[model samples]
Target: MRTPLPGVAAACGLAAMLLLGACTATGRQASDGAAVAPSPADEAAQQSTVDTKWGPLGPADRDLIVRVRQAALWEIPVGRQAQRRAARTTTRRNLGEIARRHAGSDALARQAAVKLNVPLPDQPTPEQQSWLSEITGKSGNDYDRTAIARMRTADGLLYASIGAVRGSTRNTLVRAFAEKCEPAVRARLKLLEGTGFVTGDTLPDPPQVASAPLPGNPKQPASPAPAATALLAGR
Candidate 1:
């Protein structure tokens, strides 16, 4: 081939250098991208390894988180409705306070889920939805009673769950969350009880006693009187 012009050769060399530099830069970027901005899954994986202020979360901790989140989602909206439609000032005030607390609780649950890589449901459980629908359709005293009853039922379940988690969870984070939530739930339960709307399941279960001996059955054999009692009688 005829010798290439000096200017053409120079241009060709520069283009090759530019192309090589671009490829090298792209390779560097590909290598560094993961470290520079971690994906949520990546972040979660990293978090799983690191020791948390509370002990590392376990399955029970995750389950508690999901349950609390669902409760919050269900309660907050219904509580708002109760605040607006409840006939009594006390009902309205209590509902308002509960709504505020649940809102905060929901936020905490979301933060925990993100950190733990747990997926949260966007909607409440079906039972909670049904309760909400029932409460939403009522007005005045009817609404008040329904709202309080629903809250009582929910808080009762929540209280039980918290108790279970408190006793079982080893993770400090889960324990802390349950402890923080317990007082609010108990306060709501007490307020609902005061409204007289929580009369059914809220009542303590009747003491379970053994059935009276069947009429025809011989009574349990009486134990022999103590020797001390016999001596006293003789005296």
Candidate 2:
């Protein structure tokens, strides 16, 4: 159930630069790999391409930002628990934490912590998974919360998962993002939102670990709009 996302700029952009693919200012790509996107000089001239959604990142909505980030990472839907079961892993949480911490510990830092902070119940927590089941009753389980019932994990992968808020519908924010959340969050969550920056890689926290198949692993911009594929896993 990976949403048909737009190509991530970094991934696709690098492909264009390194792989010889071409990309446009709005993100569409060309076969030549030599097309001109906005050069730094071009980007420097425009008004700040502020994502209107980030304006909501103010204190009152800290709660929503926390959840939207969470749901997007677990973009799996409901019903088909097996696929969710098949895809479950520590990757999202682990990589997610890394992305955030890479950004610091200060108030201003965590705010920029990219990646969502919505919580997921752990491998040992069926009741919690059940809670998730109640909400998204008709979606794909590939990335659904219900995947926890038969969650799997490999030995080498480290894991961590936690929630910034307690007892949220998780779906509340998912719908917002699925429909349309904020542009800034998508563009800069990892860069300017999450934890304070760090110089080295650190293992994601343990207590936060949850149901899944593999170890942990692991946002946005302004202008016309953002993308679906980019927002999904490939990004």
Candidate with maximal TM-score: 1
* Superposed Cα deviation of residue 125, candidate 2 (Å): 10
Each prediction's number of clashing residue pairs: 0, 48
Q: Tens digit of lDDT per residue, candidate 1, span 1-235? A: 3343223333334233322321111111123222144566654543343345676665446656776787787788977877778899888888878888887778878887787676777776555676788888998888998777667755665676677667766677778788887887788787777776766443333323458655553566766768887789957
Instruction: Please report, as a residue range, the 10-residue window in candidate 1 with the lowest summed lDDT.
Output: 21-30
lDDT of 2 by residue, 204-235 (tens): 11222257666434323335546676679654
What candidate 2 gets wrong by more than 4 Å, as runs, is 1-57, 73-112, 115-128, 132-235
lDDT of 1 at 47: 36
Give the top-scoring candidate (lDDT).
1
